[model samples]
Target: MSTYTVTSFASASPAFTETTYEVPRELPAFHVFVDILACGVCYTDLYRFDAVPGSICGHETVGTIKDVGPNVNHLKIGDIVGFGYLRSSCLDCHQCTSGCDIMCKERKLFSHGPGGFAHAVVWDSRFVYKIPSSLEPKYAAPLMCAGATVFAALYNNNVSPTARIGVIGIGGLGHLALQFCRAWGCQVVALSGSLSKKNEALSFGAHEFLNTKELTTETVKAQPKFDFILNTTTGDLPWDLYLSLLNPNGILCLVGFQEKPLEMKSNHFLYHQARVVGFLVASRGVSKKMLEFAARHNIKPMIEEYPMTAKGAANAMQNVRDGKVRYRAVLIVPQDSSKL
Candidate 1:
């Protein structure tokens, strides 16, 4: 019986601990083994730190295929690919058949096993996408999650090219949202509490930057109405004021995770016909399209890199917790396959 050992960083009580797992040589049909090259650290990872002790957590992963199982003709050894939040979904479900696999009840998430924070992982090949040759592994890591998410909001909503879009928060997700909306030919407005992000937001392609801290309800209502608004921050904000800034029949999409239940006035829905909708990462098809769109448009996340060591993971997590990571943080695994 041939077997191999996989090294991973598992979540501990206060930090991450090195752990190892043994796997059989034979993979299940339709699966592929990926030797991870880079993984992006996300706020979602921080949220799950203590949720399951000893569990590996990382969803934005980019790697090279090391092996492929029976029926896996689309991917081969040495092919560079990426995996996002979805692990696998039963293909027979209605949602899966319609290409919304993310909504399938039997969907297995990266949290189900040793995730991207590992030397390698075996996953259903259908959920993995080949990274475009133009995208470097490190730069492509964040796209698996952050980029896919914001892109889905636009793509799924059928946001028009002439739509006036507003992106709340200028962090990891918001930065990417700005670029995507601009590339799609929308009028992009960046909303952030701090004016310090104005220059960076504009550079990312926002047509205007509004400091939310300086705006009153009346002031927000007086500003030009947006056809769509994407909230990408976890912090609770004045939802009613945001709703007031939307044009009639506009959509306010929430992509951030907030612990508190949302509260907003009913007038927006009644009078303006405003819609509030939320979605998980993205369906597999949308994720693939997002990567291709990003590559063609030269959209990339600004990231800080750290080595994939126990100490390095701790430092990166701390930076994310302290709200210091400018845009995104990526963990670069050493390239030696022998060590892996």
Candidate 2:
């Protein structure tokens, strides 16, 4: 059988190492081979570094389809596509049938094989979405993961345009939340521990900016309550304090992952009938809709580019770890990779 060599950055050693895998010519039904052009470096990648050693770890992938299986009629060669955190899920489950594939018990991640950190990837076409022509590949990469996350929270929760939305942590996910909420005609409040990103947050569509570090109980009481508060930071925040800021029946949604167990008074939510929910990445249908909505509204993440090399990948990871990236980091593949 014919085979192709795929080069990727693997975490086999302390840092990333150059590795190659041989992919067979024959693809499974409903699968496609994608030539990765760009991939976004997410904070989740950092968390997975130590957990899955010797694995390729990138999910926010953007590329063009190079080959397709016989059953893949919707996607063809030369079509620009993107893959998020998920590769596929068992279609027989209730969650999958209800359009909540991300919640499926048997869902597969793109990181299972040669991920987007490589020059190419093969994924189930059901989860791979087409990129809109208006959006650049590098810009669309972040949307595959980060954008899908925040958008799913709002869309799935039935957040209305008239709702008062508060976004905590103006980083990768938080930044996109601001733009999406604002474009949806909601009143957006940007909440952060510092004012370092005040101006940028405003430009991204926040109607108000609050420095949480300086927020006193009295000051918090004076502010208006929010209908929905989305927390996108990994930091262990003052949960009770944020819960107090919610309006009656308001929702506190968490999209960030932290190791520590969340602690908060039950009475705080009980008294106000408030609800707390943890959101994973977007479902297949929601992910596809998010791309279309982002393209139509021109919502883009502020990103810094790095070359798709072992050295570049290491540098980008360090920057993300140190909280140095402006908003998001994207790795760009060289155009001459055909020679590889």
Candidate 3:
């Protein structure tokens, strides 16, 4: 009954374009229709665009159920839910059957097509998750992707409560990682390029701060601290010195997507017997658990919000790519989007 446009990112100048499309009153038996209240702008949305030009690009979405299919029994009208990177995954895959749907080989991503840039999204019910009633939609939007990614890194690794943890690069992921580590009872240290976020990181419960700009490789090599070092920055780093900062048998977890391939001496990992590992996003259950934990702990992203119109979204994406957004950028769709 509602008519709205599906916004798409393209190869043309100005980048974002729109097309008017009507929402069918009845959804497919396997789908759930969502009234999108907010959608988060992510770096992946911009990085992966060449693969799906002219397709809708948002993946972090929070909304209410507007309509439900006949087969959807668990969710009902007016329920609040969130959608992340996964659009739909084959339910019968080994990964799906093994309680690792996020790793499903047959999973289709929402990186393209029918993305909810407008008022609503009709999507696979399996990928959607209910949000805590008290969580704000705009704040909850990033929880679907950015928050889940770091929370998975911390949760899946079984970081000890007494461990000394260091979070590198106090940007989108590091900011949240510091808080999660602190709340998990670890003594958190933030390593960043400048002291700009020192006070903020302390306010977020970090116990110590290290400005990487001031610490030389020799200084860090002499300092055998931190049980775990989480590298959350996007650029190449002094990976060797970081490995040196770890204690014996310590783990260095990489969650950032860097442009250049990094290099480090095998001795750093061999002599001390340290580990270098990577983490992906979490399973649906973990995602929900993370949100619940965030809600309970009052952990939230520092975000700058933009309206859902084309121009607003365009400016937000530019700021994100430019690294001008404070911590995160969220696109706030109108409460009643049908009017636009």
Candidate 4:
């Protein structure tokens, strides 16, 4: 059997080092070998989650199938595919039988090894998705994770045209949230700490922009209160303050993590009859729907692109770490390989 060469970046505590691996030609029956075309760098790849030493950390991977196992009949070689953080789950669990296997306790993450940071990777056929050929490859990367995340926040919650939607942060996830909310026909309000993004947010389809620095209770009350506020901010925020902006029975969907716990007064949610709920990335089912929705609405994320070399991956990481990225950061595989 021939050995295949793959380039990968391994986390060595304070840093990432590029390394190459050689694997046997044989792969497990449920798996498929994918030649990666692009990978999106997410905050979770750098700060949120931990991966073992010498393992690749990327989860939003777009590629074309290079090989399929005997047990996998749903996919074939040369198929354009995208895979997210979910690697595998025990199919016998109740959640699996209920067709909501993303919530399975035995769910596995692709970050453990063979992540999309490499030129080639392997994943379970069940969790992989076929991307529309019409979609640009780089856009497909972030759609697998970030796009699916915010879309799920809106989709699962039953956000509607009449619902006033407020998006916080206006960065990686929030920007996409704003666009999706607008396309969904909801009146969108972009909330931020400063006014720097007001124009961009408006250009992205927000009907109104709220600069928190200049915000007042009277100003908030003057506008339509939010029926759904999607908080995509990644740090400690004035949770109670945002809660006050919600209409009665409104939902504040928390999709980002905070290092510190959020504290709120009892009456903050009680008096308004508001709810605070959070969600992880979507199930494979919802992800498919999000892809279709994005295509129909032309809801592509604003992204910064880099080459797919080791240096390129490192640059993407640095850009995300320094908060210099405009929006999503994607690493584009070289042309010779993307054609495959």
Largest lDDT belongs to which candidate?
Answer: 1
lDDT of 1: 0.91
Tens digits of per-residue lDDT, candidate 3, 1-340, equal 6543433333223466655556566677878888888888888777655455565668889988888988998898999999888777778888887767888887777764567556677888877888888889998898888888889888888989999999998887888888888889998999987687899888877898888887777687666498999988888887888888899989999888878987989997779999998877878778888999998888888899998877777888888888888788898886655622
What lDDT tens digits, residue by residue, belong to model 4 across residues 1-340? 7767887767665556777887666878888888888999998888532446666878889988998888999889999999897898998889877867778999997655678887888889999988876778799899898998999899888888889989998898988989899999999999998588899999888999988876676666676688999999888877777888889999999998878987987796678888999988988888888888888888888999988776777788888888889899998888675322
Error of 4 at 105 (Å): 0.5
RMSD of each: 1.0, 1.1, 2.2, 2.1
| lDDT of every predicted structure (CA atoms) | 0.91, 0.90, 0.81, 0.84
> Which sequence of candidate numbers ranks them by TM-score, best first?
1, 2, 4, 3
Cα RMSD of predicted structure 4: 2.1
Report the lDDT tens digits of candidate 2 across residue range 1-340: 8887888998754579888898776888899988999999999898777678888989999999988988999999999999989988998899999998888999887766668888888889988999999999999999999999999999989999999999999999999999999999999999997688999999999999989997676778988999999999988987888998999999999999967888989987779999999898999899989999999999999999999988888888889889999899999999888613
Order of candidate numbers by lDDT, starting with the best: 1, 2, 4, 3
TM-score of each: 0.98, 0.98, 0.93, 0.94
